[model samples]
Target: MAKTIFITGASRGFGKIWAEAFLKRGDKVVATARNTTSLNDLVEQYGDAILPLQLDVNDRAAGFAAVKQAQQKFGSIDVLINNAGYGLFGTIEETSEQEARDQIETNVFGLLWLTQAVLPVMRQQGHGHIIQISSVLGVATLPVLGVYNASKFAVEGLSETLAAEVAGFGIKVTLVEPNGFSTDWAGASAAQSQTMPEYDGVKAAFQAGLTDDSFGKPEATTPAILKLVDAENPPLRLFLGKVALPWVKQVYANRLATWEEWADVATAAHGH
Candidate 1:
């Protein structure tokens, strides 16, 4: 049976790859990007199996309109993939307030808008899946990418709650956490903030080390997404890539250690 899938940020990287993969599998895909023209090739190749639209995720109205259009064309959307987001790199002090807001706008609020826009339709249908393309940085953190990290962390928190909230309606929410890969994310899509001389060495070394960190192919993740779509019972969160598990585990261990160290004081404020 073929399902109708709607994906945001389909212009390139994982989004474009996944859209083509779904179409290849005989599924209907409503693929969207800020620049709709980028999807022209996919539409020309797949014809009716693919519907490409221009969507600026920061616009709530556009998100709603996109969902409405998908429903009108496909009857129902079995899956919604929120894959539109970018990375902002810089020291917190060096990043302007607007920069921080813009980072959150696309990476956090954009996701929220799209998710909210699709929720009603999914609920009405009684069964659907919402796949959130979060980052391993959401679980862990890096110095220069604080704002980006915060945005993904927000995705993690909201997705977990969303999964539990919609469980009764048969709406599944899964957060996909992937570590580094060969994607547009590290190229033109990424924003570099004004440099802070204090952090020059750190930034330079990080940039140099970036070359060897490719853990997997961004398109290879399409299989994982497909698996989740077909899963009768899916996990609330999935960590992808060779480094995802170890990196996440280390972050958890640090958290546990801190919590244990402060357990007595942390619990002292409240009296039973």
Candidate 2:
């Protein structure tokens, strides 16, 4: 059965790869980017199977309009891939307030507004899947990328609540937490900050570890995503890349150990 998949940030990287994969599988795709011209290749190759739209996901109005256009063009939006987000690379002190807010505006808030716009269509149809592209740092912490981590953490929290609230309505929400991938995340697309000399050590370590082949390629991740979309009972959270599962497990272990060690303090705080 061919389903309609609506994807944001489809100009390049993960979004573009996913859009192409879906189209190849005979799915109708509503592919959106900040600049529609970037979708020309997809349009030329996929033809009518792909509807390319110009959209800045940060604007609520644009999100609504895009959803409306998808509905008009395809009759229903069966799946939504919230992939329009960027990372901000810097320590909190190195990052300006405006920079932090702009990061959130597109990453955290944009996902919400777009999901809000698409919720109605999914509700009316009584079935849909919302896939939020988060990151491994969403649950764990990394030095110098605090703001980016915060944004993805917000996505993590929001998607969990969305899934619980909409499960009764036959709607599903999945948060995709990916490890470092061979995308432009740390290169052209990431919003980099002025170097803070104090964080030089952290920066050096990160750069030294990130070899060319260290990052997972976009095509390698497509099969896992396809499986999720095809599953009858998809997970509420899906972590991509070989590095994600083990690292996240260690994070959870540390978190649980810390919480257990502080259980007495937490219970005492109740003052009962």
Candidate 3:
């Protein structure tokens, strides 16, 4: 049976690839991006199978409206892919207050609003899947990407809680942690705050590493995402890419070890 899927940020990157993969599998896809014009080629190519719409996830009303429109068009959304996030590369001090707020609004609050809008419908229908496009950075902290890391970390927390909350209602939430993939993600589309003078060297290195050649192909993640969509019992979290698994595993181990080592002091601080 072909399912109905609603995906955000479908103009490019993993969203675009996922949309194509679903369409190829004969599913109905309501694909949205901030600029619908960017999706003209896909609309022309896929016709009715892919319904392209203009959606700015940061706009709360628009988020609800998009969900309503998708429901009306496809009857019901069997899967919702919250893949509309961008990286904000900078040190904490380097990123402006507004820049940080914009990051949270787009990556965290926006996703939450969209999820909230869809949950009532999913709960009433008795079955649904929600996939959040997080990153390995969500599990581990790295230098110079604090804002992006924070956003993904929030996603990790939100998805985990949502999975537990919706499991009884026949809805499943999955978080996808992918390493750097070759997409327009690292280009001008990504938000990179101006570098603080003290961190010039690190900023240069970060920018150099993000250039086109350093990432894996976008297709690498599409198969895993599709599998999750059709899975009978999908995992709560999936680490995509060969490189991401080990990193996430190591981070988990390291976090546990650190917590254990600090347990005495941590307890002492609370006067326990």
Candidate 4:
């Protein structure tokens, strides 16, 4: 049976690839981006199978409206892919307060609003899949990607709770953690704060190593995602790429180690 999928940030990158993959599999896609103009090619290619709409997930009303329109058009959305997010590269001190807020608005709050908008419908229907496009950074924190890391870390927690909350309602939530992929993720459109003088050497090294570090391919994870979408008992988390797996494992281990090491101190403050 072909499913109807609603995907955000479908104008480019992994979102666009996923849209195309779903269409190729005979599924109907209600794809959205901030502007639908660039999606004209997809519209021409897939015809009615691909319904491109303008959406900024941060706008709660707009998010709700998009879901409503998709439901009306496709009867109901079988899958919702929250893939509308950008990378924010900068140190904590270097990034402006507004910049950090914008990162949260787009990456975390937008996802939350959209999920809320669609949950009622999914709960009523008693079946739906929600896929969150998180990053390996969501599991681990790097030097300059603090804001992006924070948003993803929040997503990790959000997705876990959502999965437990909706399991009884026959809805499933999966977090997709992909590592550095060869996408336009670090392109001119990426948000970057000015390099602080104290971190000049570190920033220079990051810039020089950018190309070499980005090794994963977008298509590499598409198959895993499609499998998850089709699986009857999908995993709560899907970590893509070999490189990402190790890093994520390391992050998890580190977190566990830290908690264990500080357990006595942490419990001391509780006054049990």
- Using TM-score, give the best candidate's number: 2
Residues forming the 10-long window of minimal summed lDDT in candidate 2: 206-215
Q: CA RMSD for every model? A: 1.4, 1.1, 2.0, 1.7
The alpha-carbon lDDT assigned to residue 111 of candidate 3 equals: 92
TM-score of each: 0.96, 0.97, 0.93, 0.94
Q: Residues 1-272, candidate 4, lDDT per residue (tens digit)?
A: 99999999998988889999999999999999998998898889889998899999999999999999989888888999999999998988899998999999999999999999999989988899999999888887777888899999999999999999999999999999888888889885489987789988777876686565566888877898899899998888888877788766777898999999999999999997
- Tell me the tens digit of each residue's lDDT in model 1 across 1-272: 89999999999988999899999999999999989898988888999888899989999998999999999999999999999999998988899999999999999999999999999999999999999999899889877899999999999999999999999999999999998988878779999899879998878877776655656887778788889889999888898788789877888999999999999998996876
**Regions of model 4 farther than 4 Å from truth:** 205-214, 267-272
- lDDT per residue as tens, model 3, 1-272: 99999999998889988998898889999998988887787778878888898988999988898899989988898999999989887899899999999999999998998899899889989999999989988888778889999999999999999999999999999998888887878786799888779998877877676545446788877788888999989998888777777766787998899999999999999975
Root-mean-square deviation of candidate 1: 1.4
**Model 4 weakest lDDT span, ten residues long:** 206-215
TM-score winner between candidates 1 and 2:
2
Clashes of each: 0, 0, 0, 0
Judge candidate 4 at residue 64 and give its lDDT.
97
| lDDT of the structure predicted as candidate 2 | 0.92
- The better candidate by TM-score, 3 or 4, is 4
Cand. 4 Cα-lDDT = 0.90
Candidate lDDT values, in order = 0.91, 0.92, 0.88, 0.90
Residue 74, model 3, lDDT: 81
Q: After superposition, how far is residue 158 of candidate 3 from its true place, in Å?
A: 1.2
